[model samples]
Target: CLTASSNTDGATVVVEPCTTNNAAQTWVQNGQTLLVFGNKCLDVTNGVTNTNGVKMQIWTCTPGQGDAAQHWSITSTKTIQWAGQTECLDLSGGRLTSGNQIQVWLCENGNANQVWNLV
Candidate 1:
């Protein structure tokens, strides 16, 4: 599961083995807006543009509505992508093991590592 790893700002998000009480992994959202924290937010570095292998991180929240890095879109097939970017959230090295880091990469048609189930 996607987890916050910590409550601090600029924390690394990683795939951890799922648990029943995953408060650190829980998120409140409205549309594409994902609130990882109150003022700090999730981004592909908050404003950094489209680039492969960019590590997703928590940054001080952007002040306006969603942008490419700040907003996420999940296609019908469950492909989660950064808004306006060709890249989708990817498991580094396409690894599925615990503690694997997540990044943004060009969406592959049927990558098991790129397919995410939010529940």
Candidate 2:
């Protein structure tokens, strides 16, 4: 599921499982640019490279041909691989605590948090 929070304060968010009928789950690929229906692009907050459970936020998908941060490849197994990074959309560590954050990390091949369903 892809969830989006308000950009202003990072509050007021909506969460839903990825389903075939949802437009928000639909991702459009124009060459190297990806566009979500709600104009939300995947972002790793603060441009931190290491995992360590940093927050993931949604921002506008910018125009660029080979920006590594914006590049994503959905594997046949539904895991999302961020462009040029070995880390996948990880949910590891634990349930998303109220103040805790999400991050991309090395694929430990576990199911607790590293597993994600890309729509």
Candidate 3:
């Protein structure tokens, strides 16, 4: 069960376990399209190419897609890696300060601030 933040600056986003009775947890893949929650699609902001604490958001799934935010590829280890960059989604430098934003940055092993669990 991987939990993604709702936004780089918002609350935690939990990926509920996919159970036989929960279709929302089921991920539908068609080529590059990822059908999340059967409706909402994960997206990044615009097509920005920076890995320094960029914002992440969600929107209605589209056909052709929009930006790198919408482009995510899951690794064999089940880690969610952003497409445009090799950076993995990470917490804000382990500051834990209020309003700390999340960003995609280079994977640095099991850094607590970088280590994320798929719920």
Candidate 4:
């Protein structure tokens, strides 16, 4: 689960056990965008380039009005990639425990850290 550090803008996106009725874990997939905190979109920190290990955060959705950092797509191979890019969401250090933050890295087939199952 992509859990928000807090239901606010610029919150870190972490992986945690999914909990019922928890807004932090509730993500709405809008087209190619993953929306949380009602209107916030999962964003790449600093609108950085396709650099490995770039962390993710939540920012207010701007849709067609903002950078591509906030746009994502769950690829056919189950990788959550930055829209129109080859980078996928990678679990920092490949750690699955709670509080492990996610980062953007080059997508790789069969990489468990980049594979995500949307529920």
Screening candidate 3 with a backbone cut-off below 3 angstroms (N, C-alpha, C), the clashing residue pairs are 1-118, 1-119, 2-118, 2-119, 8-102, 43-69, 44-69, 44-70
Question: Using alpha carbons, what is the TM-score of model 2?
Answer: 0.64
lDDT (Cα) of model 2: 0.56
lDDT of all predictions: 0.74, 0.56, 0.54, 0.87
Predicted candidate 1 versus true structure: per-residue lDDT over 1-119, tens digit per residue? 88776777678778888788777677666577666656545678545665788887766556785555678888877888777778887889977688777788888889887898877
lDDT of 2 by residue, 22-67 (tens): 6544656655445555455666665566565556665666555534
Listing every candidate in turn, what is its Cα RMSD in Å to the true structure after a full C-alpha superposition? 2.0, 4.1, 5.5, 1.4
For model 4, how does the per-residue alpha-carbon lDDT over 47-96 read when each residue is reduced to its tens digit? Answer: 89769998899999885634688888888988998988889999989898
Better of 1 and 4 by lDDT: 4
| Full candidate order by lDDT, most accurate first | 4, 1, 2, 3
Worst ten in a row by lDDT for model 4: 62-71
Model 1 lDDT, residue 88, Cα: 86
lDDT of 4: 0.87
Model 4 CA deviation exceeding 4 Å by range: 63-66
Error of 1 at 29 (Å): 3.1
Off by over 4 Å in 1: 37-40, 64-67
The TM-score between candidate 4 and the true structure equals 0.93
